[model samples]
Target chain A: MTAVVPPAPPARLCPSLAAVYRAQLSRARGARIPLLFVATFQSIGIMVLMRGVVDGGDGDEARAVVAGSAVLVVAFVALNLLAQYFGQLRATGGLDHYATLPVPAAAVALGTAAAYASFTVPGVVVTAVCGALLYQLPMGGLWVLLAVVPLAGAALAGLGAALGLLAPRPELATLCGQLGMSAALLLGVLPEARLPEPVRWLRDLLPSTYGVDALATALEPGPDWGSVAADLAVCAGVGVAALALATWAYRRAALR
Target chain B: MASSIARPWPGLAAPEHTPDGTASAPAAFTVRGLTKTYPARRLKRSRTAAEPAAPASDRITLDVARGEIFGLLGPNGAGKTTLVKQLTGLLRPDSGAITLLGHDLVRHPRRAARLLAYLGQESTALDELTVALAAETTARLRGLDAGAARRERDAVIEELGLGPIASRPLKRLSGGERRLACVAAALTGSRPVLVLDEPTAGMDPVARRAVWAAVDRRRALDGTTVVLVTHNVIEAETVLDRVAVLDAGRVIACDTPDGLKALVGTEVRLDLVWRGEPPLAVREIAALRHLAAVAGRRWTLRLPPDRARAVVAAVTQGPAFAALDDFTLATPSLEDVYLALGGRGEGLVRS
Candidate 1:
């Protein structure tokens, strides 16, 4: 009898990173409702504290406080990043399932990064509203700054992906997240002119520095377009590099 | 006297066939000198801690035919999973080529993945996702539209008998149900080739039978090719068109179940029950050329398929051993074929 040969399989149209991000957004919004509530409350609390402290200060001093508060919001962004990474990894075993699919590993990483960015939407809105009302910050070019928010988030999400890939486990990822937020707070949130040269140089490497600087530029009375441009460049550059590294790391791990 | 003879079943011998009647099946999957080596770091005794790593897999080669349920049977850490991982595109081979469904698996993984579906030993589904959702997600990931994915998921859930628990979260299901979910997810896209790693490992008998029945149905209905990595011989024998027994990262025996069993030939054990003592001249009676060996009260006689009645006639004619209580003629089973092929320890049985 003649042998029966099986036919080839059809080509696959992979689900985009946007889809993965949407799924992650839905999951995070579902599981961490309490966390989101606390972060919103904390954003309001920080705005109130800034309002109380800025009453007797000069305009420049109030500007610094508003900028520093924007930097402090990095802590919330960092927490969201950690939560998204851990949540995805906990669902699928360390991105291996996504890696094995017909889609590119870069797409999976990008999709996950997009999802991470999506999770920070609530924090960005709350922080923006709080900063406007309590700090009396100038709101010109606020729409441009709002557009930059998701871009900054994308950069941070890429960084989180790199950390998730490099760290041995989820707990280590949490520790790294803590260290990252503390460093960002020290460098970006605090008045940079008051900090030492080495600390400033260290802060220069952080994506949060660009995020805080961009928000400050947009909210300043004159709306510094040059500073916004520079921050956007830095954020996009760091995001691309982190995403490449994360894709490389994920490929190595999955193909092992 | 029975021990004096070596060649039994001489009557059933047939002339070997020429090559014209025996056409070899073409290989659907071919692995040529495949090797996957993982690094093993060795610690140094010097004050400066330093070590070098080594590779894990040596060169291995295998071929599987179309429509064959090839079993890659091996114990834990025998590199079966590693080999399967390489085939499924989950891991890249260090060297060598693997062609599946007319495409090189490594060079054109997407093409290969289109034809192949892998059900890993560990379930690959989000715990919080419902069974239907998980299956639908897999179908969607495989490029099925939402409507098609829903229809396919429903069909698979029904096939797996998981309709009752389709809406429950996977973590809430029992272990068997979870495994069935993985199976349903693997079968979601209706890929022609399936690579299942211990698919029935933790299943009950009913579940196992159900899975086998499904496999049989798939093979008969769609001519789907299957590669089953299992140590469960009895279950595997039920549906396996052929078996490939793997040991130490190499295939030891590859053949049809009956073909392998035929290697042991036919041996009949005659249990005699005389008034008191067993026959004395029974040894002389067994000394006929048809007998292979006689041990204690039991006599193991090999009878050619055609002369089996003659041997029975000779044994029954004996006045010295007229009262033969019970006699059983036995042929080698798949398990016997496995053991005889040098599968030892706990290797032949599933855990």
Candidate 2:
């Protein structure tokens, strides 16, 4: 009995990172519009409320309110939404679907993080524009935001993904995401001068706070370029570190 | 056991033959002493109740010959899924070795990834993506290029009759449609080996037949190896070259369907559809020692091969023979083999 051998498909190699990224991006197509709207309007409302309190205040206070509101956009979608997505994916056996594929675990984790981070861009841009107008801050150095959104989004999104993977239940993961977003709001949206000495350490630890500081420094008249670059560098470093940690966490959850 | 097919399953296209040699074909998978243990979990409602850690698969050893459709038959919690997961490299085995093609599955898992296309028990990854895109993306992930992936996606979708809902989101599709989409995605990329877990779980008879036909077509056309894990024993029997019946984490029987059926004995089953109660003379036949009720209208009498002539003579002479609408005598089927080997006769049964 002869075993007939059919013509084989063209041999291809490992999973393409770009393909995985595209697939992951497509997953959010349905929620993209509503999510972006929520992130934008929510950040704008926070800015509007902060604007009233900082009315007729010094430029430093104005910079804090505007920068904080802008970074809040990243917090809303990247941190909050991403956590819930991963949490649901885990609880629903979605990881098994990816695990059976030829794709590397890191690609799955990073692709998801990149997709969630990309979703934050429109919100971040809109919030930055509205916050600057509300605070009457100069938009001269607004170009710095081009670097700020992704870096802050990556850092927050990675953390959110990690939390979702590590949590034992989906509900707990959602709670962790909400708590993380709340921390971002309290630390990122408030001026550092008003924070206590001990609580200031937490502000330093919150990745989005550096994003706010960077944007605020850039808005200053005759801004300190060195400080802005330093803050941006820290944001970039944290983004890389958080993403690596998230990839590690993904491997842990999937293999477990 | 190594012989040409006298006749392939219905609807299967004949395979092209190469006559150089057929006796020395390779084995697709060689798994030896594989085992997996899940940690014990404390009972949620009663903390005092603690269950011991159990081995899901205990020292499983099997060989799947190349170009064969092999079935892994078992009921729920029978360790079929765990064993398949280990074979496909999704879960690490606690011990022993799995050699796929030539590479060690535990040591060189990347090789298995290239050769095996797996359909998981659940379709959760691409639930939000359109069915067509899901199929195409999975093909892409399996290393098919853009054009090839699209072609494969289209061909598989058409073959499985998924054209009507190809553009619909998987979440919007019916359970059977979603299952067909998952099967289509799994069959893409022209991999040498396919591992499907419960591919026909929620499918109707038509869909189930379509899936079986597709699997048979693959084996006939490409000499591709298939490892089918399912509880649909009767339908699975039609295509299975060989099967391993697993129960409580162990393989209790392994053989071709006919060979397994022969294990019970050379018994011809006499089925009669009667309009009234059986005659006293018919029940007095010695072969009726183990008479079984099939349905309201039918009754079965299992007779040993040697006693067939006497039983036939006795039944034809009985007064109840006039009330019988129809009667058939046949060898035992795979369902009988399943029942004689401890399978629960609760689901689909064939007479």
Judging by TM-score against the true structure, name the best candidate. Answer: 2
Residue-level error in angstroms, candidate 1, position A10: 7.4
Summarize candidate 2's per-residue lDDT along B1-351 as a digit string, tens digits: 424233342323443322333223455677778888887787778957676777889888887766778888877778899999888887888898887765578885545667788888778778888899999988887778889889999999999988999988898888988998999999988777899988887788878878888987887776678898977767666878888887767777888887898887887777877777655455554346457656776777677866766666666755766666778888887666766788653453341
> Clashing pairs in model 2?
none
Kindly list the interface RMSD, in angstroms, of each predicted candidate in the order they appear. 9.5, 6.8
**Model 2 ranges off by over 4 Å:** A1-15, A56-58, B1-25, B42-51, B266-333, B344-351
Q: Chain A TM-score for each candidate, in the given order? A: 0.83, 0.91
Q: Please give, for residues A190-210, the per-residue lDDT of candidate 1 as tens digits.
A: 566777898888878877778
As a TM-score, model 2 comes out at 0.82
- Per-residue CA lDDT of model 1 for B115-174, tens digit only, reads 678887665335556788778777776667678878999998888888889888777788
Where is model 1 more than 4 Å wrong at Cα?
A1-15, A29-96, A127-145, A167-175, B1-23, B44-59, B106-110, B204-210, B258-340, B344-351
Give the DockQ-based CAPRI class for model 2.
acceptable
**Candidate 1 displacement at residue B321 in angstroms:** 27
Best by lDDT: 2
